[model samples]
Target: MSENSINSARRAALGKFGLGLATIAATGTGNLASAETTPTSPHPVVLDRFDHIVLTVADVERTCEFYVRAIGVKVETFGSGRKALVFGRQKFNLHQLGREIVPHAHRPTPGSVDLCIIASTTVDDVIKHLKAVNVVITEGPVQRTGAMGPIRSVYFRDPDENLIEISNYL
Candidate 1:
C-alpha cells in the first residue's frame, strides 16, 4: 500500500477508538500519552498479557543458563538457532551482544534493564532457592505495591547486571 493510504488507515482506526490522529502521530508508539487521557471505546481492543520479552545479553549461553538455574525456566531453541527461556506461558528471547535483530529497542544494551517476575511460592522460599543456586540477594523481602496489591519482594541482579525483582502477592 502507498504511504498515504497506510497513514489514512491508521488514522481511521485510531479515530474509531477516540484517539486523535495528531496525538498518535506526534507521540509515535514509544511515548504514548499517559493512561489518564486514554479514551474508552465502545468496542475497545482488549489485551491479555505479555507473550514474550527480548533481552540483549553479552553471552546468550551464559544468560540462558543463569535464568534456567536461578528462575527454573527451560531453554528452547527456535528460528535459526535463536535461544529463549521458557516458563509458565511466557518466554524471553535472547539476542546476543552485537547481534540484535533490526527494529529493536533504541538502545538495546545489555545489563540495562530492571524487571520484576512474580513468584508462586513464598518470598522466604524464593530466597532459599536463590541461595541454593548461588545467586546473591541485593535487597528486599519488603512490602511493595504491585498491580494486584501488596507484594513481598526480593531483589537481585541477573548475570548481566539486570535488576530482577522476585515477588509474591501477600
Candidate 2:
C-alpha cells in the first residue's frame, strides 16, 4: 500500500477507536496504531511490571499445544476456565471470544506489531533448540538493526499467527 493510503487508513481507524486506543495506551496494555504520530493523551500513568499479554485464538486447545510443546511454555486453564500460556517469563492468555471482537475477521494482521522475546542465551542456541523440536522456523538467525543498534536474532511464528522474535542482546 502507498504511504498516503496507509496514513489515511490509520487516521480513520484512530478516529473511530480513539477512546479504545486511549484506554490501551493508558494501561500500557498493548500497542495502538496511529497516524501522523500525534501525542497521546496525558492520562495518569500507573506503570507496573508487565504481567501478561493476551491474544485471541480460533482454537484455544490448538493454541495451547503449540505454545506449550512447540514454543515451550507452561500451559494452564484457570478455575474460571480461561486458558493461558507462559513462555520465557512472558504470559499469553488466549480467549475464544475474540471472534466477536471488532475487526475480528481481519485478524492476524501481519506487520501490525512484532513481539520480541528477550533471551539470556545465544540466539543460535534457540534456533537449534526449535529445530530439534521440529518447529517450523520461518526466518533468521542473522544480525539485524534494533533500537539498541545491531543485534543477532531469529524470527518464527506460533500456531495462532503471532510473530515471535528471539534475540540475545549480547
Q: Could you say which candidate leads in lDDT? A: 1
lDDT against the true structure, each candidate: 0.75, 0.62
Judge candidate 1 against the unseen true structure and give its global Cα lDDT, from 0 to 1: 0.75
In candidate 1, where is summed lDDT lowest over 10 consecutive residues? 27-36
lDDT of 2 by residue, 13-38 (tens): 54424533344434444443432244
Q: What alpha-carbon RMSD in Å does predicted model 2 have with respect to the real structure?
A: 9.5
Q: What is the lDDT of residue 138 in candidate 2?
A: 80
Candidate 1: tens digits of C-alpha lDDT, residues 1-170: 86456655655554433243233223433223331254445665633346799899999999988988888899999999999999766789988889998878999989998888777778899899999989999998888755444569999998889999999766
User: Clashing residue pairs in candidate 2, if any?
Assistant: none
